[model samples]
Structure formats: C-alpha cells, structure tokens
Target: MKILIIANSKIVFGRELKEELFQKDKNIDISLLDFASLTLFDNTNQENQTYSKEFLKYKNIPKISMFFRMLYIKKVIQEYNFDIVNIHVSRWFYLLILPTLIKQKLIITFYGSDFYRTSNLIKDIQKVIYKKADAITFTNPLTMKSFLNYYNNFKDKSYVCRFGLKTLDYIDKNRDKSKTEIKQSLGYNSKKIIITCGYNSTKAQQHTKIIESIKKLDDSLLKKIQFIFPMTYGDNLNRENIKNILKSSNLDYIVLEDFLYKDENAYIKLASDIMINILETDSFSGTMQEFLYANNVVITGSWLPYELFDKEGIKYYKIDDTKELKKTITKIVNNMKEYKRDLLVNQDIIYRLSSWKNCIESWVNVY
Candidate 1:
C-alpha cells in the first residue's frame, strides 16, 4: 500500500509518525508533505521536492498562493497515485475544499483547536470538506465528543487516533539515572525542581497568573523549591514579559526561552520533580505525558480534556483555576514523597499508553 501524510512542518509528529509507519510495515510505501514549505519527503532517497520559482513568486498573495499550493498538491498526489492521503490538522481543510483534489481514500485528523475554535466561514468550509472525507480521527475522546456534538452525522467515520510518545525511547535511555544525578548534571543544586507556569510562552499558559500565585507563598517555603518555565516556543513578545515577571517575583526560577535540543529536553524532564500545565485548552499534550513517564508529579487545569489519563489510572493533580495553583503547589511541596509515590505507581500504565510500538497498530487499523 502507498500512503501520503501531509501536515505543517512545524508539527514534528508528522515526520515521527511517517517513520513509525514505515518501520511497522516495510512493504507499505509512505511519503510526508510539509504543507507550508510545499516540500515532499520520502524514505528511499530521502528526497525533497518543492514548487518551481515561477509558481512560488506569487506565494506572497494569500489566495494565489493557496490556489497554486492546492494545484501543486493535486498534481503530486495524482503523479504518485497514493492509495491513502491523510491530512493532519483539520483546519487545513480550506486547502482541500475542492473534492477532485483527492481521488483516493482521504482521512482528516483533528488536532483540538482546529475543531473547537473555528469561525463560521471556516466551519462552512470544513462542512464541505467533511462531506468528501472518507474518515476522520481525533487525538482524544473529549475533542471527538466536541466534534460529534456538532456533526453527529459523521459518527461512524470519526475515530480516536492518538499519536505515540516521541520521547519514549529517550526516556528509556535515561531512566536509570536518578533525579538527583540528572539535576546535578544539569547544573541544578539539591533544591526540588518544580517546572512551574505552563508548557510554552503562549498567553493561554497564564504565566503571569502562576507567577503572581507563587509570589503569595512565604519566602521560607519558596526557598525549598526551584521553578523552571519552559518558554522555548510561542509569542516572542510575551516571552520577554514573562522573563521580567520572573525577575521581579523574587522566586528562585529559570526561564528557558531558547530552543531545547532533544537530549536537553529529555534531561530536563528527568530532573523535574513537578510539572504544571494550566493551558486554556489542550487535546493530548505530549509534554504532560512525558513528565508523567519521567515520574514527575503533574498538575493540570480541570478545564482541559484529559479524561484518558484518568481512565488509564494515571495519577496527576488538577486545579479549577490559577487561584488553586498556589494551594496545589503548597500541598505537593509539603507532601513531596506522597505525590511522587503516587505518580511512580502509575509509571507502567503511562509507558504502555505512550510507547509508539504499542500505538502504531491502532493507527494501522485506522488506515
């Protein structure tokens, strides 16, 4: 079978999933297309194909660029004669509005925000796109339920297809290293490393709110723990503001604004004693799952759709709002041993759910 997986290059999972698919079944030919760069990548020659300069000259214009991109993608799919064309992130459905663009079995995968936060015009466009889709997949059940609430007619075609952990292999390699050893290697002292605030530099992360809450804690209590904010990506302007907040907050903190290498990220996760993810909305967060795999006590927002973790018997804390974040942190700090032990007990369950080796079959079945 021949397959084509298309997604934004910025989303790393597109490439990871492509590699895993080929590893699972060597006979099945697979190719990945970066929608933004209009680059096509394949395993055999590891070749990359991009649009001609003549066509790319008009790329600055939105409508013209999208038109040519759609035309180019249609031509490529026809030339390759791929049996299945899977488009990740349903928001890109605007690019596939024309039914004739894809003749083979077409799958549309929703990545949370795409389905939950669309304008009426995009909704109309997706409504048309959904009619042409052969199947639809969501990363979590909550997102699926949200989709079903609107488009009940596609109930049979919609399936929950979560991606496997990209960090599972790295976690295995670093599992033997004790948290203390990893912390020392990373230049951190004996202080408990609490990965505070949230995952990124987005306004949704509510970094200021978290900082404010931490400021309310007593200085003596604060001295016992070290806070690390993973502001590696997202709004650059907001990142600077968060740095200022951390500077003035008087808390012992590290603001990570630089891009983290794979090894660096793995070591950071291993060293962390707690992870706080209070993002406004999330599907299935890869970072949150990674911390759980590393046995870090994770605290998330009650508003986020993380029912799968509860169903899998994973132990993690949740707060209703930023107000509860301070209280939760205080409790975890006071009872560090208990929180760590609870998370450690569910290590095997997280590993089983996150391992791509276990997850690849479900994706295959979806195909």
Candidate 2:
C-alpha cells in the first residue's frame, strides 16, 4: 500500500513513527510531507531572531497559507496516486475537508491537543472529517472518548491506536548502572530527582502545579530532593521562569538550558529517580510511556478519564491535591526498592499493551 503521511513538522515522535512504519513493512510505500517546510518565512527585512517568531505565529493561526497549501496538497495527492492518505495532525482540515475531491481512501489520526481544547468551528470541521474518513485512529482513550461524545455516528470507524516506543524492549539493557553513578555523571548529588518535562509554559501541561508543589514542601523534606526541568523548546521563556522560581524557593533544582531533544530517554530515565507528568489533559504522553519502560516511578495528574488508564502501570496524583505531591515523592524516595519493583512489574504490563509489534498489528488490521 502507498501511504502519504502529512504532519505539521518533523518533530522527534513524528520522524520516529515514520521510520518505524517504513522499516517494519518495506512493501508499504510511505511518503512524508511536512507543512512546516512548505510554509516559508517572510524574512525579507526582519532580523534572523525575529523571523522565526513572526513565522511561527503566522503558521500557527493558519491564516497565511491554508488556501494555497490546500490546493497544493490536493495536486500532490493526485500526482502521487497514493492508495491511502493518512493525516497525523488535526489542523490539516485545510486539505482533509476536500477528501471527496481527492478520490483516495482517507485515515485521520488524532493527537492530543486538537481534540481537547479547540474552537467550536475547528471542532465542527473535525467532525466532518471524522464522519467522512474511512477510519479514525486515536493515540489514547481520552481522545477517542472526546470524539465518540461529539459524533455518535463515528462509533464504527474509531479505533484506539495507543502511542508506542521502540526503546521499551531493550530498556533493561541499560539498568546495570547504579542510580548514584548516573546521578554523579549528570552533575547532580545522590538526592532524589523529580523530573517534569514539556514545552516551556503551555497551560495544558500544567507544569506550574509541579513547581508549586515542590515549593510548598517543608524545607527539611525539600533538602533531600532535587528537581530537573528539561524543556524541549522556547529556552528563554522557560529559563526566566525557572530562574525566578528557583530564586524564590528553598528547593534544589536544575534547568538544562540547552534544550536536549536527542537522547531524551537516556537523560530522563537514567538521570532521574522519578518522572512526573501533570498535564491538565493528555491523550497519551510518549514521556510517560518512556518512564514506565525504564521502570521509573511515574506520578501523573488525575484529571485524565478512566479510559486513558485502562491498562495502567503508574501512580496518579489528584490535580486539586498538589500539596500532597511532595508527601508522595517522600514515600517513593523512602521506599525506592519497593517502588522500583512495582515499576518493573508495571512495565511488563505496559509493554504487553503498548509494544510496537502490537501497535503495528492493530494498525494493519484497522484498514
């Protein structure tokens, strides 16, 4: 089958998924077209630094290139003669709305943000696409529930295609190193590390709650723990906020300002004692899956629906009781061995549920 995968950009997960699919099934011809590359920046007069900011705002709002790109994508679809046109990002409604015009089988994959908090108009457009597509895949149950609630008729077409990881199978290979050795290498003391990572200050990730929780901890308890914030992008904003928070708090922490993207698994899992994901809403988090794979105790916010936690192997903290976050962290730190064993058993269950093999099998059967 010839599949055309369209996405907004060539981010880590996007690139990894494309490579995995092609490597597993060479018989399947897969082509990737990123709208980010197609949308050029108007850098005729602006400084280099200002160009990207201007371009991002223009691209995000979709006012600058929707019509022209929709026409271009339609032409590309016809020219390529693809059997299946799979869209990864929801914003591609500029093209998917005209699926009837393209004369090809359509598949739509819903990542987290688009379904959780979008305008009614965008949601309506998404509903039309959902109704028209041959199949719709959601990375997590929360997104699937959102869709099912919005469009009752889509019950037959929707399927849960949970997020997966390649590294899970071999995660145990790197567990030989002692936690103390890993901490020393990373320039952190042997204190318990509580790591939370996301984009700088997105309200959806709800990182401020994690920071506030740490700040509220008693100084006696706080002295034994350290925080690490490994932001993916927007260094300046994140750095300033982190700096201000650190200055105000008695807690020890580090903000890795270089913005590490590659080796995220090694840095986050190996260097830290525990991983925290406090998102207001999440369809599925690749980071959460990674932490589970590495057998690290993961504490996430409790706002997620029951469907998202159907096959869980991690602990959850209520969003309202963030003050209890520090106490939970203390318990994990005090009984690290017991928690580690629980995490190992949990990883086994998670591996069975979210292994790439299982995910690929489901994908093949979806059509």
Candidate 3:
C-alpha cells in the first residue's frame, strides 16, 4: 500500500517513522511532505522535500503562496493516490484544514502541546478537521479528554498512541559492555544517577525550578545522586542562568550543552536510574515513555490526572512541590530495589501499549 505523511517543522518524527517502516518492510512505498519547509517550484530529486521557515509561519507567508502550497499538496496526494495520508501535528491548520474538507482517508496525531496549547481559533478549525479524520491519535488520556470535550464528539476517531522503543531489548543485547562502559564513557562516578532534560526552556518545561529543587537537596543526598542535565537547546541567557545555579549549588552534576541523538539518549537512560520532568501536568512526553519502557524509575509531572495511567496499568512517581521531590529522591536512593515491582508493571504496560511494530502492522489495515 502507498502512504503519504505530512509533518510540520518537526519532521524528525515522520522521518523516523518512514525509516522504521522501511526497515520493517523494504518493499513499502511511502512519500513525505514537510509542508513547513516547502519551496514553491522546486521538484528536483533531492534527498528530502523541505519548505522554508517563512513559508511555514502562518502570519508571515504570502496568501498566494499559501494557496499554491495547498494546491501543491493536493496535487501530490492525488497524483500518488496514497491509501493513507497521516499528518503529524495539528498546529499547521492552514496547510491541513483544507485537506480534511475533501474526501480521502486521513489520520492526524495530536502530538503534545499542539493538542492543548494552540490558539482557540486553530482548535476551532481542527474541530472540523477532527470530524473529517479517519482516525486521530493522542499520546495521553488527559489531553485526549480535554480535546474530545471541547468538541464533545468524534470519540470513535480518537486513539491513544504512545511512543515506545525497542530499548530494553537493545540494552539487554549489549548488556555485557554497557553497564560499566557507558558510565565510564560519560565519566559518571556517583552511587546513583538522576537525569532531567531542558533541551529548550519554556515555562512549561520549568528548567529553573528543577535545578532549584536540586539545590534544596541536603548535601548528603545530593552527593549520592549525580544530576545530569541534557541541556540540548534553549535560550542562551536562560541556559546560562541555569548553569550559574548549578555551579553555585556544589552538587555532583553534568550539564550536557550539546545534543545527543535518540540512541545516545537511550544509552544515557540505561545508565541512569531516575528520569524527571516538570512540564505541564497534562503534557505527554516521548522521553518519559522511553525511560518507562526501560523499567527505570520515572518521576512524572504533577498536574496530570492518573486515571489514564492507572487504566493502562502504568505506574510512576508524580512530583510538583520540592518537598515531594526531595522525599521521592531520598526513598529511591535509599532503596532502589523496592521499585522493581512497579518498574516491571510499567515496563509491561508500555510495551503492550506502544510497540512500534504493532502500530505499523495496524496501519497496514485500512481502518
């Protein structure tokens, strides 16, 4: 079957899916259109099709070009006659809204912030888009519920699609060399590891508060846990402020200024024992899923509703206040062995809900 995937600037997710599909079935035929980075008339055989940043900005692009892009995508889909067209994120309403108005098999995944945080007008536009969809996938139940309540319909169109990785098995395969090799490679020498990501600092991610909480930890507990900040991307000034805080705290920590690819991130997860985040209570993180799948202790954001995780048989520690944060850290460090049952349960639930292999097989069916 032929398929076309439309992704905004976050085309990495689509590219990864395309690669995985090819790996699973080399004969599969698929096309990708990164509408956020389109060029007006260049159909040359480049490695990938990309649009410019200006073209993607809803307020910046000329109206005529917008119409042209719509025609370009409509023509591409018609010419290819794809069996399924998947749009990765919903914020690109102008580009995707019209696609749903016509007759076609369409699937849109309401990934992360785009589902709950976009402007109301866009959400209203997507109300019609969601109705027209053959299927809609959400990462977590809370965001899914909020979205469905806003429209109060299309219940059947919604599906919970969590991101899972073959990580545990990957770690098991390289078990012999990994345990020590990775730790030594990264120069981690602490009794335990605590990791937080601030690739980009926004109020939602709460990079500052996370660091300040670490500063609040007592010297004894702080010394035992080596903190690692994957400061992959963010405003330079904000990152510098975080760096200064980390410096003054005198804690065992590593602020990774550069980025690590997916596999590298997995490698770090394998060596670490705790994963932390402070995003919006309802935010569903792809990285959190990876750590959960690895059976490591995952500390989740607090503003979330737990019924969904409970329904899925998932388990995690939730923290909002520094008091809860410090207490959870102490408990985990004191007896990391106690979390085995919870970890195993989480591991089972994640694999059951999010195996990419299963998702691909399901996609082959024209639902």
lDDT of all predictions: 0.79, 0.64, 0.65
RMSD list, candidates in order: 2.9, 5.7, 4.6
Q: What does candidate 3's lDDT look like per residue over 1-367, in tens digits? A: 6667776433245665665666666676766677645532212214443334434555255666666566566766776677878877774544453653345678887776776678787777667666677898876777788888888898887877654455545654544565567777667763455554533544566767677666777787876778777666545677787778778777778877666655565677777778776666445565666667766687766675556666787878877774477777778777788874567777656666666765555444433
User: Weakest 10 consecutive residues, lDDT, candidate 1?
Assistant: 93-102
In Å, residue 202's CA in model 2 sits off its true spot by 2.4
What lDDT tens digits, residue by residue, belong to model 2 across residues 268-332? 56666677777667677766766767766777666665344544634433334666787887787
Identify the superior model by lDDT, candidate 1 or candidate 2. Answer: 1
The residue ranges of model 1 lying beyond 4 angstroms of the native Cα positions read 44-49, 52-72, 75-79, 92-97, 184-192, 257-262
* Candidate 3, poorest ten consecutive residues by summed lDDT: 39-48
Off by over 4 Å in 2: 8-12, 39-62, 65-79, 92-101, 184-187, 190-194, 197-201, 233-249, 257-264, 306-320
**What's the CA error at residue 92 for candidate 1, in Å?**
5.3
**Model 2 pairs whose backbones collide:** none
Q: Where's the lowest-lDDT run of ten residues in candidate 2?
A: 39-48
TM-score of each: 0.87, 0.80, 0.77
User: How would you encode candidate 1's per-residue C-alpha lDDT over 87-162 as one tens digit per residue?
Assistant: 8877653455455544788899888867766776777667767777888998888998988887777888889887
Model 1: number of backbone collisions: 0
* Candidate 1 backbone collisions, by pair: none
What's the best-to-worst order under lDDT? Answer: 1, 3, 2
